[model samples]
Target: MANPTTPTASVTCSALSYQWPDGTSVFDGLSLSVGRGRVGLVGANGSGKSTLLRLLAGRLRPSQGSVTIGGGLAYLPQNITLDTTPRVDQALGIAERRAALRAIETGDVREEHFETVGDDWDVEERALATLGSLGLGDVELDRTVGRMSGGETVLLCLAALLLERPDVLLLDEPTNNLDLVARRRLCEAVDSWRSGVLIVVSHDRDLLERVDRIAELRSGSVTWYGGGWSAYEEALAIQQEAAGRTLRAAEADVRRQKRELEETQIKVARRQRHNKKMDAQRRAPRIVAGERKRSAQESAGKLRGLHEERLDEARERREEAADAIRDDAEIRVSLPHTAVPAGRTVLSLRELRPRFGRLLRGDLHVHGPERVALVGRNGSGKTTLLRTLTGELEPLSGEARTFVPLRFLPQRLDVLDDELSVAANVARLAPGITDNHIRSQLARFLFKGARAEQPAGTLSGGERFRAALAATMLATPAPQLLMLDEPTNNLDTASVRQLTSALGSYQGALLIASHDLPFLESAGITRWLLLAEELQETTAEEVRDLLEAAAAG
Candidate 1:
């Protein structure tokens, strides 16, 4: 049952308009209202999900309308900006406590009792408790944020938000960097949330399935579907089918109207010719001849006007049909492949060992053409092993070698240059390629036209990944081996399918470290590398048993 007395929050927009500094309108007359409970926000890139979140959080004012959020709200932006030098405990506890004290001094907290308990030690204990609930209990509070992995940092931010206990929580792509275990932890946290409204924006279907309802945003409008991810998908299919039928009907109407206009034109021409012939044959008075000529001109003028009117109507209908079709077009991605033949030995690791502050050990060995998956808990060294293989991190006492040319895509796409435009980045990576070639390559990855010229820093998470792939794969000779770290983290379903298809068809070897179960299953992994206290190789059946055991626990 749902909790009562959670302030029923309502949001509405009337004639709302928003424009960027460059006068590009993002939303015009867009209005939406969300009540209580978990709501998933779905949209394509640049559909203004973030903008709407800000509006609901009262951080951004609408250009022409008022937005009312009637409760205490906490917002988690998609990209969190943190001071990496601060220790985790200071970042979450000490700093927050100091801020709370300052707020009390400034009269921000009206209750005298809150100011009285300003120095209470229980506050820090509560912060620790919240962190534990989010599965970060094992994390060292004294560790710097810079030393943590992307997934760990994101989890810490979520823990901080949960500790605040706001009346509403807005999370944007909260699970993007998390592994399977951490993602499950977040799901559990969201499910257990009570007395608050939660609005989440994500491309994760599994996470969306846990929400109470789904709200789809397309072309600056919100459509609500009662139920979870499956319901949203069904609704989208129905809409696409209806849009297709409308387009077909409009096309047929346009053809019929064009034919009718052509016939009317022919009739008018024949009538003029007949009148002219009759005038030439008749020895009629000047008055009668003048009246006939005037009548003929008047009739021609009215018929021409009517023909143009019909053509205009037909053009409008055709445009409407085109608009509808455009909305339903699926995102398309094309991953370029190189003709590198499979090598005899894909990757070789000898006595590889990675240590964690002298407390933990990870050792492993892997070989060629093996679809190996590394599984472990959140803090384990699964990613560390991959880094060692790529030489990003040196192994403590072992040798790792790849016989073939290798390409690596990191979890965060740090390979991309944020200051450069997308085209420039691609061009820099493939210097031998021409500007036209670079543009064509990026177009396959769905960055075309003006977007191709946009700075890389401005792209969404999915677009950034596409740009990275285009820059990496389109070189003169592509790498024989591909290593991807959580490549599907922020990608939509369509993009993921494209990548999987591309990888499956490539003749070379791939070593992917990901927690995306569906993707791994579809890719047909032949072997698995389980990373617990140490690295162990096993068959697919053994891997499944291990996963089941973990789940049962």
Candidate 2:
């Protein structure tokens, strides 16, 4: 269903349409209204969730139709980059107020200073409280943003937005690069949303679970579901189940109609033969027999027409019922060459300290087809360790060795050459592999025929990921050891599901670094190693328990 109509809607769009200059349409004749509650907007990668949010936030004017807003709106985009030279207060849009207060304390009672400060004397206090609310309590207001971590910068951007107290707030993938603790803090912010219309475009389940309702964007339309992520999922399951039943019934009707049509045709043919025989046997007058034949033919034609119409209607129903099913297709590929022996060592690390991040002295050995998870805070060196293992960054002190063919899919997904087609990129990685063979393997990664020939730069987020994975897996002497760093960082739910399915088809040792515990657990991780000053083994249950305890505390 579309969002409920109400005068309380803080943000609304009517018959909106947006198209790029290149004539690629993102939305067409779409209408939606978001009122005073937390609405979680979600969809597949290219389903226009972000575009819709932008349109509502007034960052992009509608190419056609109208956009209506009840009050001030603030937006936090997916990628936030603040200049490092600016102090926290300056970045928060309160530098002038704070400086004016300082100047007033120094005995300069200028009118402009009072004008800048206004009557809001507690702006500093409010700013600090906002920062602390997002778990940046120690970050001094005078400090430059360069001193902050990436996650802290994200929180800082959010803090600036929250300071506005806008009537409508829009966040797009707010937790894309946050650590576990930062994500929790964001979740808390979401939980405490009571001010105005808070609409978030995110696939973070934790954040999504905090919303009052879910708005799914698909096929240039908005579908609203009450409650949070779990409720929406349950409702979807029911709908799919009902759709399946309807589709089966439609199929059965099509079959029955076809059979009836055949029966009618047979009966008509038999009657025609019988009438012809009667006309011949009786030797009736030519006019009498002709009239009877004409009547019978007309009756047969009407009966045939009726049956054909019924069959056509049944087929149309079948087509519509089929359309109700989802289009999330899974990738299935066999890679027997990727399997590692039970007793073989795939990697060995000793006293390995990378130049980047905080990974201290470490000694670890990975054997067999073990799927190991690297879990830690944002600045805790998960990516550093992965890079160190890949020898992309040399360890500061010791040896990091890989004994098998390896592949690393980084968070940036820079493995593919942007100028080349997906097939060409795969061929570049696997030099000796034939073009047909490369294309054939690419098909299994869900890039079939023309898709495989498409340039990597033109693909959407999920398609680009698939193309990168295809290039990695289809390489010569298949990757026996695979490493993925924050693989699900910005992926939507559907893309995440597709990634899970793709990983299921691989037979290799894995070392994945992510704060997404649910995805890691679903990856069938054989071991969970929390990275800190050292690596410590843990279980999925223990990890969940720790997260729960953290939440409770």
Candidate 3:
């Protein structure tokens, strides 16, 4: 529990508005207030979640409104790129130690406080302790961050934020790259944290469930809902259902009104024609002629007025229906595959070994068509083995063979060019394809129309992943072997589900090196290549037990 005397922080924004230089307005007159406890921020991609976080962190100033953060704040960004040359401990406490050393050297602190600066050992020890609390206990303090896995980097950032212990903690997709175990550890840490307000921006249902309240951002407005993920989902479902009903009703009403208006106009036209015919036949009867003409004109005018009014009503209904449908333009992709027979031996490694100076060594054999998951703690040489198998790096000894054409989707989406448009990237990857063909292929991967024209740099993480897959899968000859390295790093639940379904039905063999247990489970992985202190083939149950043991320690 947090202490009563601990300074409480309140965040408030008034009539905030922000627009990018390209005239894209993200928020308009948005206002929100948050005070103490854990709050979950939920929104679809491009709903201003990141933008709002930047503003709250004071990284960016609001264009039209004021934001007040009542206390010191610490922010953990979604993608944390680290200086790989530095050790884990050094990276974790770099800012803190630098500040302390400056204080001492500049005489800003009294000599009495010098007792706190005995040696660098204390700083490293403190850093390790903080990291350990976040389940990074086994991470070597001297190990370079570059050698660490994506999951490890995410945990390191969390450790840094924990060490900072600011009055307010702002985490933007903190669990994006984390595996199930690491995610659970993070949730536990947040649950146990004291003396600070926590604001988490994430689309993970499980993570959101841990929060005290949920705030949803849609159409540049934030709606606060009390309770956890379940409650928030329930509320959203109800709202969507109501909106759908309203939309259907409006459509029906508009259709009926349009028919009635058309019928009325036809009747008016017929009456005018009849009046004209009657005047031509009886030109000598002036009184009757005048009366009939006056009646016809009056009727025509009334009919026109009614038609206009009905049209206006129908237009208003259409607008209302459009507003009610949230994110109607959401991309849906269909992953089609031609039947490809799996070979008995997809990948084989015999007496394989790899080493990093005197640090690590491994002997392994991996057989294929089997969904073998490489499981281990951070810095446990999972990536090394992967690199060796792919021939990106040579093994210290032994032989590794990939018998089929392999497609590697790296953790970083390294194949994509940020400056290129999504369509252009696809075309560059698959050269002989025509532009129309490329567009059609991209559409299957959910990049459609203007979205396909957008630069890769402007896309969200999920979108980028989809685009990468689109480019890779649409090659002239698709790879028979698919190797994914942390494939679900930054995907939302929906995207993850879609990928899982596609992979589940894929005919090609899969070799996934990931810490995402849920993803592995969903992909129907039964064989496990446990890569901890040693290389061994084990059952899924064995792997789970090992993970539990590691997490317990």
Candidate 4:
């Protein structure tokens, strides 16, 4: 699948800029070049990574400047929907050619049929091979997409994009909804990409680790990191370490300067007091005394000014040093009341069967404060199982019960009301809770003072997520059984860390459904449940091995 001979494909932007109609400036005069190789685009939420991808793909017009691609470009958007009416071959843009080939085989030597086939008489073969490469080999060429699972559709879309044979490929969060198996297939595609400019925007760590370089988009600018995610993190760690040392030195300088200034003031004050005493006691002639006093005053004034100036300069340097340090604030909240005892029976799923998805006759007993990870391939009933446990979707034929207060944060995060203020939404969920108490708790989630009163619709992605999580955790009756479905779906790396920290304070049972293994491990997941036809308890090592096995298969 790889082209060993490196191609000279590239994507370049010159003084590019973009702004929404709401006057939100995403980028201003941004310029960058992505040469042939795999490039991972990473950034915090609202950092304009997606905007840059759209501008490169020509899906969005830059407000100024230009975008230049060395060759053909194909973009795989974050959200994809396929019409069930079209056959697989048609989706791959080879239906007409396949039809023409069939016509020629039947002795219909029409000029148009030959023209359609052209030199690509093996177009169908190529299409099938590409599908097979993406683990969709069993997908029939004539079958509609309606019969396929979501993961299958994603693979189909990727297969179609590969069929185009573009020189530059742009993928925006391609693994967002893909299961473990589909993710492996996509990873293989990236691994085999030896030529052209491939830029992918994803939060998936494994996918990011496969990149040749990482271009971090921050503050409307791109900073390049050689190698992959691990390299980038190592560089950042080294930089932060150096920054910490610099900051400490700057702070020490400020303190020393301040101390010198104070000593100078004291010395000047004592000198003044002595001069005044001598003058008042008539120790010299009046004229001489006045001259001496003026001289002493001027000298003290100069000394004070000199010391003050040094202190000011030291403060400025300290400020600059502090600015160099990143603000990776973690949410530290207390959850003493949410803690459950060791003997508590939190949840029980007896012969559970969701209305849909792959989970069948699921049976599990969650006791005490166990932290469980619900992992499975796409369309494996992970979400269905969560919803069934939440009672949103009734089980088809089994019993589902929760003994303690439970809360579920679904993938969509639709728990918050758009029209109400964040504080108001939390208050609505926590009826009878005092406003003072709610505001105090919200402050722990980083919503202090006026921020708590901001409309839910106006909050940024990270802020909204924190607010939703705050509400879920800080409900009227504290939730002892918390369930999160793909909690880190669109969260940036820093935000993911913040989420993990918040979960650290959670003393109750946690049942998280996610494909992000790193986040699960960070969240202190005590047990791993792989959901398919049945929920199977597995180890983290085996869960990780699933990727390698899937790719090999």
Best by TM-score: 2
Model 2 regions more than 4 Å off: 1-9, 284-291, 541-553
Q: Per-residue lDDT for 318-361 in model 2, tens only?
A: 99999999878888888889999989999998888788777787
Task: Quote the positional error of residue 190 for candidate 3 in Å.
Answer: 1.0
Q: Write the per-residue lDDT of candidate 4 for residues 1-553, one digit (tens) a residue.
A: 2232436588999999999889999899999988889999998888888889999999999999999988778899988978988888888889999999999999999899998887887888899999999998889899988888888998898888888788888999999878778888999899998658899998888899999999999889999999989999999899889999999998999999989989998999998898889778877888998899899989989998998998899889889889878887888999887898988899999999899998878889998899999998878888988888988898889899999999999888899998999999999889999999899988888899999999999887788899899989888688999999999988888889889999999999999999888889999999999887998999889988975687678
Q: Write the per-residue lDDT of candidate 1 for residues 512-549, one digit (tens) a residue.
A: 77777778878777767767755677765676566555
Candidate 3 C-alpha lDDT tens digits along 32-151: 888888899877666788889999999888789988877777899887778878877577765456556668878778764465454552565667787788787878776788877767
Give each model's clash number.
Answer: 0, 0, 0, 0
User: lDDT for model 1, on a 0 to 1 scale?
Assistant: 0.73
Instruction: Give candidate 3 regions above 4 Å deviation.
Output: 1-4, 81-132, 136-160, 163-165, 277-298, 327-338, 355-372, 501-506, 524-528, 533-545
> Which ten-residue region of model 2 has the weakest summed lDDT?
1-10
Score candidate 2 by lDDT.
0.88
Name model 1 segments beyond 4 Å from true.
1-4, 11-16, 58-64, 81-133, 136-160, 281-294, 326-337, 354-375, 449-451, 494-507, 522-527, 538-552
**Lowest-lDDT window of 10 residues in candidate 1?**
326-335
Rank candidates, TM-score, best first. 2, 4, 3, 1
Model 4 lDDT at residue 333: 91
Where does candidate 4 stray beyond 4 Å? 1-8, 281-299
What C-alpha lDDT do the candidate models reach, one value each? Answer: 0.73, 0.88, 0.75, 0.89
